[model samples]
Target: MNQLELLRKFTTIVADTSDIDSICKYKPEDATTNPSLILKAVNLHENQKFLNQAVEYAKKKGGSKQEQLLNASDKILVDLGVEILKYIPGYISSEVDARLSFNQDKCIVKAKKIVEMYENQGVSRKRVLIKLAATWECIKAAEELKKDNIFCNLTLLFSFAQARACAESKVFLISPFVGRIYDWYIAQNLMSNFPHNEDPGVISVKKIYNFYKKHNYKTIIMGASFRNVKQILLLSGCDRLTISPLLLKELESNNTVFNRKLIPPTTFIKPPVSLSEEEFRWEHNQDEMAVQKLSEGIRNFGKDQILLEKIISKLM
Candidate 1:
């Protein structure tokens, strides 16, 4: 069997894209879409209809350009997400505004609004997973959303504190970004000396996994943004891994034994000493790489979201 088939034995592979056509080709169990991916996908000629529909819908809404366009963009994203769900048995993740990455109340309101939009269109709440940034405020917002039976997928996670907070909040799932972590090491020129099995990203996820597994936290762990098939294979036995279709094809083309590496036994080391809010703040403040990267990721996503909204306005 190809490596994809082998990995499927231990990990659920999810397509991390807004391109439903590509997803249909590879047949991932579930799919995930973010503002960046949605913006990228809607730019294609084949995907133009998705954007055109948003424009038409926004025009019909007849509101201020900013308001109508953002509303329509969100609607377009939801529509495509609903369509994606038709092929996969698992849930489809639709992210909220990355601008709300730091706003607790706003995040809660937007998350509920997205859920209601999906419900209004006949998509059951259970089939839709709301993706939010893994910030302290977002985790608190998730705590509220969870109370109402709404599930969440925390994204942009780069450290253990974010993951721990999500677990403490009882969120449904967490998408710790493996590729971004790799990018951090590359930027630091630490790649040559980077340890594969216990790389920073792997170590971060392992801590989160052990915390959940040891304390019996129900929040699922789904590693995202993988740079290579090696990272995917290293994270074997993770609840899920959201991989781009390119890497999925690579795994399928390679014939080899895909080892199950991320088991509970590997976490024999005790979870990192727990930290209070103040201590967490201090620790995060000390890790310039984590702090800078987290801020950069949020800012980049926010910028793309705004750009998408602007494009919608022009088309309308």
Candidate 2:
């Protein structure tokens, strides 16, 4: 079997794209999209119809200019998510605006709005995972959402603090970004000494995975943002892996055998040390790479979100 097929034996493969064709082609168990991916999709010829429909719907709502723009952006994201959902059998993650990363109340409201939009279009809440940045407030928001039967996928997670808090909150899933972690280390000239298995990004996910499994935490770890096939191959037994189309194609064509690199340990480790809000903040503050990348990821996503609104406004 090709590596993709082999990897499936031990892990759930999720596509990380907004392109309908790619999602259909790879047939991932679940799919994820962010503002950046949706922004790219809206500009594509084949996806223009969806974009136009959202804009038209927003226009008819007859709100203030800013409100209309925000409405259109949300509608476009859900419309794209709705389309991707038709092609996959499992969940499709729809992210809240990254701008709301710091406010628990706003994050909760937006997450509910996205879920309400999906439900209004006849989709079940179980079919969606509201994606949020792993800020302490966002984690708190996710904890509350879980009570309402709204599952969440905490994205842009980088440090053990983020992972620990998400697990403690009982989030449905957490996407620890592997490529972004690798990028930070490479920028610091620290990856030259590491092999594929020892890659910093890979190591980050493995640590999170082991922590989750060793403690038997129900929160799922879905490794995301892979830079190469080796990263994906090395993390073969994660709960889930959200892979981009380019790497998915590479795995599909290569018939290399991939061993399961992560599993629940025979002896579970003691539960992770707990952290209060102050401690969480301090721990996150100490990780220079995590702090920088988390800030950068939110800023980058927020920028794309604004750009997406601009495109919708022009179309309107």
lDDT of each: 0.83, 0.92
Residue-level lDDT tens digits of model 2 in 1-316: 9999999999999999988788889989999999889888888888888878888888888789998898888898898888889999999999999999999999999999999999999999999999999999999999999999999999999999999999988899999999999999999998777864588989999999888888989999999999999999889989999999999999999996767888777776678567899999999999999999999999999999999988887877
Number of the top TM-score candidate: 2
Clashing pairs in 1: none
Whole-model lDDT, candidate 2? 0.92
Question: How many residue pairs collide in each prediction?
Answer: 0, 0
TM-score of each: 0.92, 0.97
The CA root-mean-square deviation of candidate 1, after full C-alpha superposition on the true structure, stands at: 2.4
Model 2: worst 10 consecutive residues (lDDT sum) = 265-274
Off by over 4 Å in 2: 193-197, 267-273
Q: Residues 139-160, candidate 1, lDDT per residue (tens digit)?
A: 8888899898899999988877
